[model samples]
Target: MEQREGYKRELYKHWNKGLDAGDGCDTRREVIISEAIKAPVVTAGCKLTGGSWLSPYDGVTVSDAGKLDVDHMVPLAEVHDSGGYAWDAGRREAYANDQGSPSTLIAVTAKSNRSKSDKDPAQWLPPAADYRCTYAAEWTGTKLRWELAADEAERQALLALAGECPTTTVVYGTAP
Candidate 1:
């Protein structure tokens, strides 16, 4: 496959330029708020101080929102390599800030998010064994949502994972 020339993280304007919801919080904060198992207090500057969250990627419960990372299910670089290179700047930005789908942006432990990095199902699976099926399904669904294509290795990995978890289903909607 021919790799695209440009895939700098800057191409996709992540978290947006300013406050996205008129509140002080940005996209990342919004995701944190939505995913928190226990609602955290929003302070004067939209600082999230306390929250209990379950990082599905590692099955770790986190008490500090600061310890959580809002991860793109299909990490940005993987999205670029998976055909997002063809997307226009606006679409790229939208993809980066997408919150319409719960599966697209997940809140997980910082460690888990960093470890997974920009890897696809072919390269990485969640450390939590129970999340493997869901992760694969969400990864496939996110690719489909953005009209992105998966390479052969990723396809095979997802297929093999599907074979292992026959009951897991992928449900997705086209991104606007």
Candidate 2:
């Protein structure tokens, strides 16, 4: 696949409160709520307080919502660099806030999520060694679901990681 040029995170709009109309929660909060180990106490306006979350990336358990981040499995800039630069604004928005599949967006510790910002498997992996297999599968599944292109190095890294996770399976449908 030909790589796109001039990729920018601004190309995709994210964290829209209205993405899921009438849900009252923005994309970030929704992810946190769904992934919470114990459901948080939500206010009438969808403000979340006091929740416990398990960060799959680092194997850390966090009870503070402030420490969690909603990570796009395929980061926005990576998506734009892959094929999203050509997508219409609505499609970009959908990709940014995609919650159709549990793998699309995830809740991780803010530290791990930032460390992974826009980097593919070729450049970054979870700090927790045991999570590598699941991470690779999720990464591949996200790329496949979004029809995103992976560079040769990224593909090879994913394949190698898959070898370590012989039983891990990826099941996904097309992106919106």
- On TM-score, the leading prediction is 1
Q: List the residue pairs that clash in candidate 1.
A: none
The lDDT for every candidate, in the order shown, is 0.89, 0.87
Residue-level lDDT tens digits of model 2 in 16-111: 884566879888888899899988999987888987999999999999998899999888888888888889989998888888888989999999
Candidate 2, 157: how far from true, in Å?
Answer: 0.3
Pick out the ten consecutive residues of candidate 2 with the lowest summed lDDT.
1-10
Candidate 1: tens digits of C-alpha lDDT, residues 36-60: 8899999877898887999999999
Q: Which candidate has the highest lDDT of all?
A: 1
| Model 1 lDDT, full chain set | 0.89
lDDT score at residue 84, model 2, on the 0-100 scale: 86
Clashing pairs in 2: none
Q: Which parts of model 1 are misplaced by more than 4 Å?
A: 1-4, 17-20
